[model samples]
Target: MSHRHVAAIDAGTGSGRCVIYDLTGVAVGSAQEEWTHSAVEGVPGGLDFDTRQNGALIDRVVAAAIRDAGLGATDIGAVSTTSMREGFVLYDANGEALWACPNIDGRARVQAERLTQAGISEDVFRIAGDWVSLTAPARYHWLKEFRPDILERARYMGMLSDWMATRLTRTFFTNPSVGSSSALFDLNTRQWSDHLFERCGLDRAIAPQVVEAGTLIGHVTPESASRSGLAVGTPVIAGGADTQLALLGLGRKAGQATLVGGSFWQMTVLTDYPLVDPSRAPRTLCHARPGEWMTEGIGFLSGYALRWVRDAYFEPILSAAGSDLEAFDLIEAMASAAPIGAMGVVATTGAPMQSDNWRQPPLGFIGFDGNTPEHALGNLARAVMETGAFLANSHLQKLEELTHQRYDTIQFAGGSARGALWPQIVADVTGREIEVPVEKETTALGCAMLAAVGAGMLDSIDAAFAAMASPIERHINPDPERNKLYRDIQNNWADVTMAASRMAECDLFEPIWQPPGAKFTSMTDIRKV
Candidate 1:
């Protein structure tokens, strides 16, 4: 077969990226453009984005990447897309988007709670193989209750990746990996659940057609080709959700687990059968490949927490570098200098799991005295990194228990993997070897491999990945002493998080610092007013 380049577009939460890669998975060119996500004015916890605007940005990046590659439209053999899962767009009969909501939007929490009250969470989990979520189904529930008019007017609903594929291929479809995340799909049947639609008061007609990932949906239309700088008949392959695509991109097989550390942290294990112990809170979804499932556990606000530390504490470094790219160097250097255990400071990075009954735990810090110590900054940085490690380790341990197999090594991907200290911290804390790939954007690379499959350049997804697999750049081994130190700290963090969660349950915290036995009258009176 002749060698050719394929293009992959990733519509992520913060930005849209178009990357061009050859058969061997070497990036020829890449371009990314950011988009805005804002809260809806009248709807609390509603996050929305413009569908058409995002499509335009995707086209712009595709054009830019082609230019950077110095290749003509016909040089690209095929195109594929992957995107943030769970978010969807409501379309009218004419295929015009009425509204769009992102995964982070929690406007449907109340609706989801209603389902939980009705006591169908277990049945929902049985069918979907996932925890009850305030995602697609709950969004439909919200619309049915509050905006029945829009519900009646809408003809079709599809995930964000489906919409992007339609923009390029002029076909409306979604893959099982994307569909399963919507909380409206039956994992066993790999189709939209009729009972779920009935529960959410939705019409089954509104659901998009289901297709397998890497299947050829359609060729790029003339209009889209002109906009995106691609050949009119370029094959547009169906791609799965970003998380699943990342797994394929990292060349993960059934025996392995992967941790994708982005804005949110995710740990997924590839298994032949769906890992469906309702006791395990991890979400089980179909993999991009047939007859395989990914058991996924998610930690919100992981890498973002580190970004918070950067902007909050590393102002001088940010000023010197004038951008986040260079500021990370200083942060990593400082974190490297800090001793293990973050000097007894425990940074509780992720909140407790579903049973907490409270809102997200406050980002807490413990064991800090009033005065700033000499290693204060390093301690703070290391603590933040350690928290992320502990959170990942917690999920990894759970995954091992559920699957009855231990993972000696984990493939680490996402932007955060570019940082040096964080991966080692995770290795030491998790007591597992960490493998970092040469390419950081495994999600896009995964899409490119699927594109290769659709283009007939590779016989199968496995073949495509084997041909284009990137080499591992680093292998981080756990330090024995540090691992032991972190074991105690990880246990302590659980206690600390539980205590903070309990404190949050009681929202009344008096400022009086005296012991119960000491006199509190003076301090209480002074602070009461």
Candidate 2:
């Protein structure tokens, strides 16, 4: 009650970190331990990482953050974690990860296909408010059927955060956001489903205990404290998946929506009630907002698509002259060089030009006659950004059918949202007024707020966000002129999508994957080929 503090062990695909937040929802201290994700190229490429190493990174960074905060483990009030979802760590009785699988490692598509074949997926979706995914629960299916040997030694298959929480508190529990990612939990009941358990051939225990975010899970154990450098008795809260954490950091309340525009771009509108889509692009997930859930419209390739253009095409000029810190400086300069529509050079969002089926290729060139990189660069940037916006717009229209609500303004937070020009373009393209929060790392703030609620410093997540939240600083209103032009571009992009879908139906441009044999042991084994 004296002074409240919270900590986050952010387990990312590439790194793990310990972040400290004060009562005001500001980061007081932070420390990072880098990790790597290994991949074998196919559709998603086999995105794999060393789970044990990631856990070690968590221990190292937590110690560093405690030291940086000028406090030992005992001073912190509570701790929670935000982590990459879908990857499950199989545990033995000793709480050690016998083995693990990364999320959407591009291998579970077959299992997802199998679920589709069984016709039980639709039932799972109707009840769980989750679509069958090539991750998490489907992963259990793949493992149980394919790797019976490994399953013999495995007991619990929990997300990275759940495993870490169990490691700290000596109790196994799951957060709402993480459980939703499982594709097995009934969003309405907020618990595991007998329907899904039987469908996937998974055990009921495979469903971890669901805990509401901001619940006081427990204190760190002596063993965890010894290694993590936090006090053994420091309270730990049930945090959530990183996106939900980011949503919290963004100060999501009952009504406000969040735009997470990192490598992938997702726009979410929250409601306690969720509507699920099976065949279409707009998918829904449980929101980090307590008593409420959210519907997510995601674009797989947003920032990464633009980065590809920056590298494969503009690297010689941009890289030699500009760095990532200064990337926007160069990109904006280049964007300004091009005209409004990049001389009719249309950009795409993975319709016809689906590279690895994630991102659309560079903006299709129409009138490329002696245009410099500066002139061409903006078109590519605009195209990718607009195409992404158009895709999000398509989803927004679809999700409105379920929410019976519309977002008047979008709160943009991400690396790309920092750019003044791109944000305006996003606003103009989406035709919605965009509000940029004071802090871009809303996910971090979101996680910390949940932790605060768990620590009993705040009664509710909404109250914590409302009391701590401030007004937006930068705002972008849709320009009448650019909005009109982008509308036309959006129409063109729709035409492109229709054509691509048709071709895919015709099987003219199809790709096939014959699953690798068990000979494919590690990501490394597949990578060397």
Candidate 3:
């Protein structure tokens, strides 16, 4: 018997993927394409996205998925898309994009500093539930400061997924789940804050109409259908941000914390109301489900570091195998053979940083005794894994302190959770049980679930999730002995991190060096050392 299917587009930091799934949560066809942001000369952390090019690629990938599925456009019930949060595109009145900024774009650091200095940081945190990072506020600030002409001509500002939905369906709508990441969103009122727009020197009218997830934005236009091989009248679902969508895919509920182990690590807990605590500093945002909230601590550099180490160091050794799975296997084998505590080496992932503070923790190892490359590789892998664990535990503690809630189980997903050792490490370090679900592409599954809901195939998101979510595949329980060892390690790591922060605060390494014959007046001079 032929089964019904839905298409989902997942646009991530480095790549875009389209997957078609059956109603039983089984992936029937899939395709992926890697896309990169163009680099600008002499601009540190500057990246530009071209939506026209990206939209075309999205069409191609979605068409490819339909072809691979061996189904016609009429067979697919609906289409939905999810993307990385924070990155946005500015459009003119004609709906043509002027400039696009991804989440990685950091050209607005100067403006961000300006806001911090002007005491706008506290106000933003109170209203938006987050500190000023490289998101909309800073991007808008940069546009107002450097490119005022473009700012003057701007008619629409939207997150990347919202822009995609508009291109496909000719409707401009953004869900509160993605809006939660924008510094302009008001946490209390669940709407755009006029005060934030005034402070950022942007007009609130530039923002799109806010909607909830699972809402039918519009039907695919004929032009889009021709380009994407989707039905002309296919219902387009308003999917939310990638992280929250993944949580929805997991069928998450209140009282559960989810660890999305991707290139960036986020430990998020679902809540019934907005919980804003500057002391905790975890991001508080609206959940994909209406009337729910999510608080998270993110590690921006954890899994990316592991991927870098693998590609730079281990890939060559396993190049003959021509399989990433084999390389990961070797990495896991080496790490498992290494002595506990990585032979007295500690590597930090440089995450959970405070933007308001000037001092940042250094990213790397503190203790290394010139070990062999293999030993170092093993230790490096262990360090990377431990860094994720440390960050997760830190966030868990912060959430517990702020909400007075105890989280004993962490539902895990994303690319990093594929291996057995990493999950074990996380369980051991966090001292919590790790539950792994059957689906590997949780984000894609989430979009598909939303599509089903929008197409009337499912009554609601909860109903869709209950119908499609597969059973838990594996469970990792913490080892008592390893948990004790991790506690001590965490304490020591804390002490070293404090020392580093203090050193940075004092600018200890910035003193000028005195050359020979130069006058050195004090013993604290670099020449004295």
Residue lDDT tens for model 1, 100-135: 887677676667677666765556677787545545
For each candidate, what is the lDDT?
A: 0.78, 0.67, 0.78
Candidate 1: C-alpha lDDT: 0.78
- Model 2, position 282, has a per-residue lDDT of 51
What is the Cα-based lDDT of residue 411 in candidate 1? 85
Query: Residue-wise lDDT of candidate 2 within 197-237, one digit each (tens)?
Result: 87777777745678887788888889888878888788888
Off by over 4 Å in 3: 1-3, 320-325, 353-355, 358-363, 496-529
Residue pairs of candidate 3 with colliding backbone atoms = none
Show the lowest summed lDDT stretch of 10 residues, model 2: 520-529
The TM-score obtained by model 1 is 0.90
TM per candidate comes to 0.90, 0.85, 0.91
Instruction: Report the Cα lDDT for candidate 2.
Output: 0.67
RMSD of 2: 6.4
Position 402, candidate 2: lDDT? 52
